[model samples]
Target: MSSPPDPEDLTARARIRDAAMRHFGEHGFEKATIRGIAETAGVSSGLVRHHFGSKEALHAACDEYVLRTVRKLNEETWAAIKEGDLAKASATRRPSGRYHRYVARSLIDGGASELFDEMVGMSEAWFTGFVKGDGEPDVPVRDRAAVVTAWGLAIPILFEHLSRAFGVDLSTPEGDIRLASALLDIYSHPMMSPEEAAAARAGLERAARRSTTEGTST
Candidate 1:
């Protein structure tokens, strides 16, 4: 009749996960050792294994945590939209930038493929749902959504070099707000007229045709 694990121990498990995410973000998945993470979390390597089973499983847990957080933000934003409060809905959608460095490192390392795909899939599904009906997105919409997720969200975090150039640290609260405001300004305003859009499409079509012809010629 051994006693159940203490509630504090359960809490320590969360701390371990947090430490692991930070290490993975800073050192990358393959480079981040289990012992290093455990030491960072103030726990033994055996305890970390006891809680998370293995490094791969622990990484999965971290990805799932991020997914759930994004899903919750989406749910809140959706509720606000249903209430006819677009401003409120947009304001409600704020994902923490704490893990931004980790994500950027992961991107550069070319590891964490599972986490990346899952995040992109979730974004695609969410955007698809917002369109006219519950149908899969057409190629253009899906392509746009994927690009937006990468450039609009991930790139900003990945390239902190931009922060220095822009005179703002995007990891901070005020800086994030400033970046968001700049993004909103661009998104809210139309950059081109219908005629320009048509011309751009024609140009793209010509480029595609040229590429196809060159490929067939070879």
Candidate 2:
């Protein structure tokens, strides 16, 4: 007869999974190793394999964990904004902020496309509701906006060098608040009036037409 699952086995597996996610986020999937993750988790390499079967499977679990964390963050952001408190809704680096750093690095390393897509999909669903006016932008515009938003959020973590140049340690709470305030200021203010925006678009269209005509003539 088969024996039942051990609670200790479950605990060890959870520890391994958490450690693998941290390693994958920090060093990336290619550079992270089963032995390294096992060491970080304080478990044996054999235990890791027994629990996850392979490094690829462990990476998959890490991806799912990232996705779930993102979804929870999204929900919390929405909740705070619904209460009319944007400041409260702003993304804070978590207590175990290593996960956040890992995510940022993973995106920069090009190993988190699935996470990016899931976020964009979630944003599209939320923003689609706001497109009710006569001048509502289409899917392509929304896609580009979402990508820009993702980059804006990722750049600070992805390129810590830039933060260093600015004399700000973004890993600290003070620096995070400084950056958040600046971003909030920009987002709250209109960059241009509608008339100014329309004029800018017209100028761009004219330039585009000229370029096309010049190409055709050549």
Candidate 3:
């Protein structure tokens, strides 16, 4: 009789998933070949096909794995926030800048661009649902918008920080966190008026223009 799958087999599978994730992150979906992944995982290419079926299935699994990690991190952050552990919450929050870098790199490295869009759409849907809660006990639209905005700003900042921790180039997490905190402070100011918002918009526009000019020149 054939032996049952051993713990070593499970560990090997997990290693394959990790190798796939790193390869995909570095080279992207389209360019990340199954043979390369198998090589990285120290397994036969045939084994990879046997486990994941196809490149598309492997891509889906990778996306699902990343999203799952993000969701778990977010949950941990929320729990810390609820428990009034600000430091722990900050540490546990998903790094937004890192995520943005990952997406940008994936696009540049010929990764599956469609997968990126799908991930973002999924995130938006999840965020909307979380903000809306039960429609039966409807929240004020303004309050919901505020919550959504806060979350939107926070997530990217967390990604930035994680990217730095992981040694990825692009914006540092500390910088993103500082910027996000400033924005949050401005938004939460007791005396924040329309004038302040207008000024902030103007400043943001100037920054964008400067960045565009620099990019063009380079």
Candidate 4:
């Protein structure tokens, strides 16, 4: 009798939720404001509050949205991996690389940085778990390392693709892939002795200094 609670109102709420996600993704939780989101979504602040109750609730909703997206992407990747299609799996799973462009666009176009970071962090944790074999003790370390290396490689490549997709020349795709490969190599190595760890740290420090110096000169 109430006209199904107004489909238009439901659509407006969905728009507000999407706008809030973009704002939170771009600005982060501490900075994204309810009024700002309402304004961006072309809704009154009171209506936004009426729908979400509070900023915290809105943020929780944004997190939920991001998690759902990541889950969908992961499922796609898993399907590809199960079929022994590494290329397809990488294509599906490399959120940071390919998906970042959409995220950046969302931030630039819709102002959703906080949601983007949440998604990034969630994806990183997922990949970390994949690398660690989800607590399966019987899973061989070598196999885990291989998967981790592949993940690392995939991230940078995907990022490169995303950069291109978004029309941002932040870094070359090749560079990203190379950096990811190096990081994977480090992670795949056997656990170092304390002395070895200390030496590795010192070497890393030197490399960092060298990089800083080169950056300054350039």
Candidate 5:
């Protein structure tokens, strides 16, 4: 079967959208302008407006584009994992890196809660598939997935901090490898033992129950 069309085409409209994404990521929604995005895309402001109406409308288009791209990348990753193809899964980093900064910034930009929630919902479905037993999981899939999604979002959002700590520019491949190496060390060494984790979970549950009770009592 033929492969699906790549979304990052060289068309004028795609260029404008990509430029707008980068601008919005770097400058945020309030500061980024249609004219600036047009200049970056090598198009006229009028053309940008012609293609996307207004800045708000253009941003909405970007939201749609990024979500679609992320969904595609997520599927590729899961497929690679299922096939035990480490090389293929690792390759996703390159294409995804191009948009990583934008996604990280976009999440915190106003009105992106829908995007964040959609990502959580997407991960929840995937986590549910990993449930091996018919019995209840120790943690609910939605809760677990939401936390994991937030953690994933945090990496790019904290890129500058990570880069400064490592003394390397993480946007580059070498710095990425350095950070990944440290992360490997971290993953290899679990911070908490199973006993500690069980204890923590119990404490958290108690705290949650107490908070809920207090809220309902008022």
Candidate 6:
């Protein structure tokens, strides 16, 4: 009988998946090839087929992996938040490495609706539970969460534009510093005072009411 596949060979499945995600993230499905993925993973194309059967199946597996990862992270974040350990929650959201590349790719490639919807639901729950826990959101929590999710997803899609605007490649250390500094400034220094923000929200509520009254009349 043929000797069992080497122990190293048994671990090829995860390597292939990681390599496929990298390829699919950098290049779309049509551009990424099984041979290229196998080469990156240091495995055989036959092994890729043996594990996932086909490119589409590999892609589906990647989606499942991403979904599972996000769900786990969100759960950890939620638990941290409940315990008032915001630092832990923040850390939970900051995953290390190129894994997130596939998240951006999945958003762009379509057919990740389950993943997207799951994120939206988690975002809605977060906004409802914490962001506006003491008061009403300017918009409904679900709508607000959806918009926030869109904005978060837009980062990868708009990465090039942001890099150009910042005049630095976002993949570099300097770019990370610059971007983090900018975000810090934006979050720390509110553009509007409490009164101004309250007034704006009130105005929005008034406009919403007016629109509702007009619709009722019609």
Best by TM-score: 5
Q: Judged by TM-score relative to the true structure, which candidate is superior, 3 or 5?
A: 5
Report how far residue 64 has shifted in candidate 2, in Å: 0.8
Candidate 4 local lDDT, 1-218, one digit each (tens): 00122254368777887788667655766788999999999999999999899998986676565556666666677667567775565455444343343354444444444654544554555555554532344344455445554453344336566556556543545444444355557867757776796798789999999999999999
**lDDT by residue (tens digit), candidate 5, 90-174:** 5555465777777777777655676789889888877677425435768778888899788877888898888898998876777
Kindly indicate the candidate among 4 and 5 with the higher lDDT: 5
Question: Mind giving the per-residue lDDT tens digits that candidate 1 earns over 1-218?
Answer: 11233354368888898898899888888889899999999999999999999999898888777665556666676677678875665555434465667667766777557656665676676666653533444356667666766775565354487678669876666666666677868776768876896799899999999999999999
RMSD of each: 6.2, 6.5, 10.7, 11.8, 3.5, 6.7
Off by over 4 Å in 6: 1-10, 159-218
True lDDT of residue 133, candidate 2: 37
TM-score of each candidate structure, all chains considered together:
0.76, 0.75, 0.53, 0.45, 0.81, 0.71
Q: Ten consecutive residues with minimal summed lDDT in candidate 3? A: 130-139
- The Cα error of candidate 3 at residue 146, in Å, is 12
Q: Which stretches of candidate 1 lie over 4 Å from their true place?
A: 1-10, 81-95, 121-139
* Candidates 2 and 5, the one with greater TM-score: 5
lDDT of each residue in 156-194, candidate 2, tens digit only: 365477567658776666666676677768766778888
Ranking by TM-score: 5, 1, 2, 6, 3, 4
In model 2, the runs with Cα more than 4 Å from the true position are: 1-10, 91-96, 129-135, 138-141, 162-168, 193-196, 211-218
lDDT tens digits, residue span 1-218, model 6: 11233354358798899899999989988899999999999999999999999999999998887787788778887888788875565556555225657777777778579877888998988776665333555567778778778876776667778889999976666666676568658756879888999899899999999999999999
When 5 and 6 are scored with TM-score, the better candidate is 5
RMSD of 1: 6.2
Model 5 stretches with alpha carbons more than 4 Å out: 1-8, 131-136, 173-190, 205-218
* Model 3 stretches astray by more than 4 angstroms: 1-10, 94-192, 196-218
